[model samples]
Structures are given as structure tokens and as C-alpha cells.
Target: MKFYKRTETRKINIGGVIIGGGAPVAIQSMTNTNSRDWKATVRQIKQLEETGCEIVRISLPDMGSACNLGKIKKNIKIPLVADVHFDYRIALEAIKQGADKLRINPGNIGSKDKISILAKEAKKAHIPIRIGVNAGSLKKVHNFSDNFLRAKVLSSAAMEHVKILEKHSFQDIVVSLKASNIDITVKAYKIFASKRNYPLHLGITEAGSIFSGTIKSAAGLGIILYDGIGDTIRISLTANPVEEVKTAYSLLQSMELRNSGIEIVSCPTCSRCEVDLIKIVAEVEKKTSAIKNLKRLPKPVKVALMGCIINGPGEAKDADFGIAGGKNTGILFKNGRLIGNVNVDKWVEKIISMIKDYCR
Candidate 1:
């Protein structure tokens, strides 16, 4: 059932987290809070940590913000990456403040000398640098009509930045080529991966609000990851960063690349459905979202919530645990066998109780 065969790339250490070189694809998210607000930033990061975010990035808009990187890093459990743009001094300050990594946009981070300075400092600090290239910010492309050509330009821009770092004997680097358009993003990553061995951080930049963003990121990241071309991912959404982390986990789990959390297989209610299947599934999700470390279970937990006997029985049999809904009652299946009947009202509680025991 597993469809992923990870692309092999050199490993880079950000804090203690290892990325690429066949490591499990790491999930990352950036904070939207003011970087100077250490308490708020730390609080958001802690929430992300609880939801399984392995790496967190914070934007450094000013010198004051860059100075607070260490304070924020001290309070969080995950790797901290300082996102810098336009100014190399901010990146230098971020390195001095003990940032685990630095993410710089190639288009605006300035001259080769500035890049060398950042490279030397980063190498001395032993921190990796992520060259984040975005299609909308490309300095080389003005008006390109072809997606493939745009992809080439994006890939070339990334390589040019990489060379600046590599020329200074800095090799601990990660790269991201992002475009709001899925096709351009995928093409850009493929071209870059084919030419180098640096670890890639995947994402769809400026992907709209939650509903649209999730679908776009899932489709784009899915294609790239399926081709075994990415090492890490950030589901950029115009929603809470927590949703981004959750979406990243869902995408990875659906591909069989990760085994964590509850995987719900619920049916789209049909005319035959006699129970409120939608409400039941929503209740189950709400209750189980608080379950910590479900990955510690022996295997991924599959919970099915089917509305009728037609596809219910089959899906329930295939899942680790499930409920096939009926008029006022439901059929419970656990470990591929009928456990017994339970009233529809108790389905959510039953599933939660079973998961707790299974996880234990």
C-alpha cells in the first residue's frame, strides 16, 4: 500500500533534526505572530509541537526581532529557522542568536559578497541555510508565457544561489522552489532535483485560504512527493498554522509515507443512510484530535464511519475498527470481526474508548 520511495539527498542538521538522506520527510510550519512577541511566538510553536510539527520558522523583520530568536528557541522543543529577506545583516544576527537554520529568499537577499558573509558565518555556526525561491519573486523572469520556461528560470535561480554558498565551501544547505501554480512548482522541483543532491523543502507559496490552499498544496506536494523528489514540506495556508501541520500529516499519512494520528474513512451519506453520519464523524474527529502520540501504537489506526450496509461492511472489515450505521443502532467491527451492536448515540464514545485502549 505504500507508494513512496524517498529521493536520496544529502543530510543537513537543523538543531538535532535530520532532514533528507532518507530521513522521514519532516513537517514544518511558520509562525504568523510578531517575531518580537516571544511569548506569543513560543505559545504558537508549543501548539504546533503538540500537533507534531518537527520544525518551526519565524520571520525576522527587524534587528529587534532577530535578537529575540534565541529567547524563542529556548522555549520551543522543535528546530527554529529564522526567515530573512532583503537584509543579510538580519541573517547574520539570526546566526549569532543561535538559530538552528536560516531561510533566505534568493531574489532579494542581495549581492554575492553578502551571501559569502552569511555563508561564512553560517558555516562557522554550523547551521544550515535554506535557499527559498518563489516564482512571484523571480528576479530573472519578467513576462514568461510558458510554464516550463518559468520552471527553468526558477530552477536556475535556485542553482545560482546554491553556487554562491557552495563556492564559499558551504554545503549544509536546503532548497525550496515554490509557486502558487502547482504545475510550475512541480516542474521546478523536478528540474532542480535532477541536477543536484541538496535536500529540498517543499511548499506552494501564497496558496489561498484554508479550503483552497489545502487542496492546492495536497495536489502539488502529492505529485512531487510521489515522484520521490522532496525531503520536507510546509503546507502554506491562509489559516491557523495548526491546520497546516494537520494537513501535512494527513497528506503524508494518506500516501503511506507516515503512520500517525487517526485515519478516518467515512462515507459520503447517501439516501440509504438512516443515521446522522456527518455529525457522528465530526464528533469522532473532534474527540480524537486531542489524542497524543497515536504513532506510538503498533500500527496506524484506521477508523471507518460508514452510513449503510452497502459499502459499510466491506470498509469496516478493512479498517482496524469501524461502525456501520443503521436506523437506531450500528454494527461495530474491531480487528476485522464483528464486535457486536451499539446504539447510534454511543458510536463516537465507543470509537474514542477503543482508540485510547488501542493506543495504550
Candidate 2:
């Protein structure tokens, strides 16, 4: 069944890319490197761009790092965003130095006048602004019952920033309401989405390491995106940023919203198993890593490598191509029809050649 996205009204441009108005959901990631270190920061941005990150954000903690925005912009292909906190001056400097986007909470950036000045500079630069409100930093007036209070605070804070940007006639904007709690994060986004037309950036803030973070991000992002609520997404993890990109694409794939390169469907080896499915899947993943630019399969292809025929061919009948195990031999199938029998040792090489031929 085709999922219908609830397209938000506002269409904001981040550099040359548009967010909202039914655009393809953009994938975003932030650099963990210190922005003052140009070399490290540039290298990370390049790597993120290579990983299919449509937008990259850098933390601009002070004026010096904010000034480095121009240099960072010169080196990266994707639009660069400045993540600023409390200082409107840094936000202004970042715009002057070519930041394509600014992530700031106007309420925390000193005063309404200062926010206006920064907004004016951002408007003059033709850059979009993202009002990122996190649960950990809610304002004092927000004291609803803790049960639903986080969502209320996040939504209230985001709207307040949105108002400041709108007041200055700065309509190029996006909004993110992130919380470490999955339920709160989901609830906050639903509330904001119900009330605003600005593009929503989806994420579960401070989600733990690779394993835990992927689960949290997937659970929260999955529910929201499935409901047609997100315009852009980031799988925020404490691990390497590359993993974040991979997780984002995986989440998109699960929702049938986007696809990148190969989607391998494999089964866990059980007592009925005969081959090393895990090792083979990993090798296949590495070999096809170069095909990341193909956002969706040209033709739908499901390549399954299963441990045994007990549940193999039937389980993978939808696969365009697949393999099921025997003792030391395996059966290869294409579109659920048996193709040939091959030794288990040659499975990886044979699968790679078959994929190459299919792509051709």
C-alpha cells in the first residue's frame, strides 16, 4: 500500500535543497568534531557528504568557530548549518561567513531585539533557520504535568522561536522538537505537526550508542514517519556519524519512504541451518557499499540468503533473487523459481556477480 505523506505548507531551502511541500525526506547528520579545528571538521563534513547526508550541522560554540563557517562551506558539498546556543552574535557571524542554515533557540539568544538582528542577517544572507528545542532545556513558564509537560514545553518553545522568525519576515525556517524520551519525542512532534506548517526535523536526542540508539531512533522515527509527519530525519547516535547516516536510510527503507543501494534480506541460522549467513550478508553489504547514490532500486530486487529450505524459498518468495541452503551446497532462485545449485563456498562471489548482471 502506498503511504500518503502529509505535506507541510512551508517550503524552505537549505542551500539548493528544498524541505517540505511533499519533497523527498532529506537525511541530516551533525559533526562531532570541534568546529574550531578546520581540518578535522572539514574532513568529517566530506565524509558525511560521501555517506549521503543531505545536510550537515556543526556546533558553533564561539565567535572563532563561527568565523570558520566560510572555510567549512568552501570544503563541503552539502549545505552547512551552524548550531548555536545563547549567543546571537555567533549566529550573525555564521551567516556572514556562509552558513546555509542556523539552528538556534531565539528565546535563549538574549533578547527579542537580538533575535531580530540575527533574523535580519539570516534573511539578508538568504539562509534558512531551524528552531531546535530540546526537552533538557525547556523554559521556566512550561510546568505542565510531567506526563505530557515535555511535549507542551517543546511545542511551546518551538512556536515561540517560529514567531520571532516570522515577525522579522524571515519565513525560511524549519523546526525540530527533540527529547531523549521516545514517547515524549513522538508526542511533541505530533503536537507541533498538528499546529504548524514548517518542515519538521525528526530525531530522538541523546540516543545512546549504536545498538541502543538505532532502536530508539527507529522506534520514534518509525512511528512518526509512518504517520506522514517528518520532512527530514537524523538518527542521532553517540557512535560514528557514518553509522548515523546508515541508520537514517534504514529507517526510511523500513517505512518504504526511501531506499539506498541494496536491501539484503537474510535469515538467522538455526539448527536447520547449513551455511554461514551472517558472514555472507556482511560481505555482500561491503561489496555493494559503492552503490549508495541509487536512492531507490531501479527495479525492485530482494536478494535473500537463507540458512535452509525449510522456510527459505517460501519465506523469500518476494525476492527478485535469492539463495537457500543444503548441506554443503545451496540453491539459487530468481523471482521464486529455482535457477541453479552451487557449492556453499562460492555463494558470496556468485551473488555479487548476479547483482552486477541484474544492475546491468
Candidate 3:
């Protein structure tokens, strides 16, 4: 398959992970837990790390939260980014407290002196700053009558904020133009890519709950990533933040941009389906996910769980391990060839065993 020609942008290191300049697109998620609640936030961040989140952001709504950054940083393995707004002092405190990166709109920080201070402090800490410009927060995002025009407006706003940092000789920067509307968000990124060589942080701002947000993020981020425009991605969802990281990786996998983890391609059951395909698939996914973030596997093992005999065998044949149902029994297969039949009750255990063997 032909891959999208990725745009070459300046690479910025967020902690140890690199973004842009043709590097692998990093996955990011924000902690929803109260930042001041050190234990809970650290717990959530650890969970995100297990799920393959490379960069994590936490809100610095007050000085108390900002002050706790050092403690949180000591507990987390991946890069910790602080999300601050309106106040440059909190941004300054976040840097001194050991934030690996900062997410702040330079334009909203009051004055050029404040922005200069933030830039100098962040550079001294060897941390990059992300100029997050959301369409909802743009000065004229809604003032424009046309949707497409609003996208241009969004892009323009981000560039203007970017210039403030550039004026301070701060080039260690990443930018994002996010909107809940996928089309507008995509357009804005495209426009910005044409004008700048800064690494981009991609996401649909406030992308709804798990169910709907996944679909929207996949569509919008998929399109933008396909254009080879994004350097890092965060699948924003109102649900548990872990879902965000999982969904980001899934999107990258779907685009064949990533080959990490076990990718189970199962069929949606039809009238011909007689077995409990949903339950079996869910169990297999849950059990096998433990090996996902590890480097133990030589490669991702494709497991197909088909509901019926006709399409099941054909589809399962392609997977490293798969099963097709027939009456009360299902035919187990290895690499497209049938091995044997098993009771439906044993399906989950059998798949789990195959996975363990493969990982070994």
C-alpha cells in the first residue's frame, strides 16, 4: 500500500519522545483528575502509561496544582505536559516544577513580556511549549459567516500566537488548531501546514463521549493524519482518559501507520450467527491486551472471530489464529487451516491459550 507523504516539520522533543520531522506520530491524553490530588492524578497517569500514552497533559488551574508538578513528574515515566491558560506565572511555575512541556495560548497570556518570560523559562527547562488554539476559543471563529472561512480564521489565530513565541526566539514549539467540527479542524490544520514548519498536536477539541467521540476523532484525525499533517494526536473524549489513548492507537493501526498490539478483525454478527460472538470477542480482547504495550511479541497477531461458517473460514484463514462457529461447536484454525472443533464454552480459553503461546 502506498503511504501518505508526511510533511517535513521541525522536530520537537516532548520529554524523550520526538514529534514531527517524519517521526512516528506520538499519542497523547490529558488527565481529568484534579491536578492537586496528587495520588489520584498519578494513578490515572500510570494507567495512561500502561495503555501506551507517550505524552500526558494535566490542567494547571491554580498555583496549588502547578506547585505539585515536580512530585507528579517524579512518579510518571512518560513526558508530563502542563495545560495552563490566561496566566503566565502558573506557566512559569509549571516549568520550574519540572513540566516536560507546556500547553498555553501565547495570545491569551496578557502581554508580550509575559510570553517572553514563559518562552525563556520553558527553553531554560529544556521543555517545549504547545500553542493550543481551539476554534471555540478563537477571537473570530464564529464571526465568520462561512464554515470554511472559520477554518481559515482558526489557522490564522494559531499562527499569530506562534509568532509571539518566535519573536522571543523560542522555536521549540508545537501548535494545534482544534474544533469539534471535523471539517473545520481538518481545514485549519491544512492551512497551517502550508504556512509553518512547526510540529502539530492534533485533536478534536471537546470531542464528546466515548461512543460518539471515537467516531468523530477517527474521522477527523484519520483524515488529517492521512494528509500526513499531524505530528502527535490525542483522541479527546469525555469518557475515561484511557479510552482516549486506546482510540488514538486504534486509528493509527487502522491507517496502517502503526502495527503495534493485537488487532482483532471480527465480523458484526448476522442472522446466520449462532454463537455468542460479542462476548467471546470482548473476552479475547480484554485478556490479550496485557501483551499489547510490551515488546514480547514479534509482531501483532491478527485474530478473527466470525459468527458463521460461510464467511468465517475465509476471514479466519488470514489471521494468525481464528475460530469459526458451527452449530454448538466452533472450528479452531491456525493460519487459515482448521485444527479442530471445540465446544462454544471453551472458545475464550482456547483463544487466550493461542495468544499466550504466540507471545512466548
Model 1 scores what on Cα lDDT? 0.91
Q: Write the per-residue lDDT of candidate 3 for residues 256-348, one digit (tens) a residue.
A: 766556888799999898999999899887887776533345556788888987889896677997888878789888888888998899998
Please list the residue runs of candidate 2 whose C-alpha ends up more than 4 Å from where it truly belongs after superposition: 139-145
What TM-scores do the predictions have? 0.98, 0.95, 0.96
For 1-360, candidate 2 gives per-residue lDDT tens digits of 447656565888999988898887999999999989998999998888888899999999899999888998998899889999988889888888988899986446677788788888888889888988887777642465574676877888888878887988888889998888888888888898889888999999999999999998898888888778988889999988989998898778767777675678899789888778888899988887775534546644568999998889999998888899989889999998998998989998998888777776
Specify the poorest-scoring 10-residue window by lDDT in model 1. Answer: 136-145
Q: What's the TM for model 2?
A: 0.95
Provide the lowest-lDDT 10-residue window in model 2. Answer: 292-301
Clashes of each: 0, 0, 1
Off by over 4 Å in 3: 292-298
* TM-score winner: 1
Global lDDT for candidate 3? Answer: 0.87
Give, for candidate 3, the lowest lDDT window spanning 10 residues: 291-300
Q: What does candidate 1's lDDT look like per residue over 138-237, in tens digits?
A: 8565578889999999999999989999999999999999999999999999999999999999999999899999999999999999999888899999
Sort by lDDT, top down from the best? 1, 3, 2
